[model samples]
Target: MVEVADDRYATGSGASPPLHAPRPEVEVVTAAKRTRRQREAATVITADARCTPVLVRAAIVGKARMPRAALEILAPNGAVIGNVALPNTSADFDLHQRFWLVGDPTPGSVVAIVAEGGRQIILPGSRLRSGPAEGQDWSGVACRMLGWERRVAPTDAPAGFQAVFSSDHPTIDGPGFTKAVRRFRTAAVTIPLVFFGFCFPFLFVIPRLVQSGTSTLSLLVLPVLGGGLMTMWSAHCRREVAAQAELVEGGAARWGKEIAFTQSYWASMRKPSAAWDGPMPAAAV
Candidate 1:
């Protein structure tokens, strides 16, 4: 195991962490309600679109450096975009922004997002070779020393091509996409049902029993009825299940070997660990 001699994660205070780049476009307004770093990160992604979209293939890399203060987003003109704090995740990234691609660079602009600190983001036409980070890798490792969990070999891209996460990139092109679809299916079913089941008694049974306190039988019957209602609701949501399955099939068709990588990452970021109400890490980049 590679020991982080300078394990930034070792700290408990609201200090910066190891790995990733910083945007020079924005000034950190430590006065804001968020950690100084998080606020600064959010400001960078949205300001001047400091993250202007380009047609670049992206790959993850890690480099050890003297930990810098949470990065600042720099303006194209070399001025700070603004002095403000922000939520951790990229402000505007949504279902449409996350994707993987295998094609030429296309004309026109899309929003580039800053996520997972500054290290995780989409670059334009990078053509970086990719392989697993924490898990096993069949391909040879590039550099174990650099923190970049994955290495992307650069490539020259052609013109007039485009891909979107929901559309082209799902065709099972790589591990990223494969993980995406699998996670989506597992989470889609688990998340809602888990929460619904937990809340059933308090939200439904208790209320009904309270109103029908007139009879002891109401207590027993209401509980059963609530359970039945929950079962019915789950049954009624088969269409949602089908939709998830369809996306799984669709991703394989669209991206080939890759699954829905972006979707999965997004889901993980949004999902609470341990419990539904458990606080999540600032959206994993």
Candidate 2:
């Protein structure tokens, strides 16, 4: 019989560890770093607006520095109607007096502000309809900025566009108030259902406990059912809110990239051609 060398029992300076030896585990963690532009984008202070059928006016406030910022008015189909240059200053400016025409006055129109460094802000638009405007039969869209009067000065919008910002504006109109009312109505309906659901399990559990005159495993069922229902409802509400917030955030980011691309295209288009180079002579070699 031939004897094979046993490396597991070998002890020497060059000996390697056994194959069955356990190796230590290490966890590596990496964190993403945000650029200056991303930091500026995430710090949007607030964007407020007052919309009318023909005109859309808005104000944006922030703490970042945006040079040569311009507001671009977009049509319902995402076509750029025009862009108005904003003052070159910090991001804390207002557009109280500035307003633009819809040209077509179609619904679903939106507004965006793009700056030199690709910083952009998008504001939601209001729905339009036929309503009373300054004692005249006019059909237009109107949306008032929430808490605008308390935060900023009264809007100096033109006469025809003034009614949208006042109390005369339609109660059921504008996405601002419409969304608020919808959420309120939802809460009003769901609160009662949740309360009844939590109590519903108790009604049967208590009656059985009283009749039996002894504690049983069925007692755990009421608490478990009630807790599960509440947890599910709370999770649903949280997911809804988070989804809406993410939609707004994703839209803003996408719009910013588009604006940056458009700006670069225009810049390249306007760039002057370099001096023409003379033709090289092939015989010089």
- Scored by lDDT, the top model is 2
The segments of candidate 1 whose C-alpha lies over 4 angstroms from its true place after superposition are 1-214, 244-285
**What TM-score would candidate 1 get against the native?**
0.25
lDDT per prediction? 0.30, 0.32
Query: Alpha-carbon error at 80 in model 2, in Å?
Result: 38
Whole-model lDDT for model 1 versus the true structure?
0.30
Report, for all candidates in order, the number of backbone clashes: 41, 1
Candidate 2 matches the true fold with a TM-score of 0.23
TM-score for each prediction? Answer: 0.25, 0.23
lDDT of 2 by residue, 48-89 (tens): 222222222322321111212233344445554443322222
Model 1 / residue 175 / CA error / Å: 26
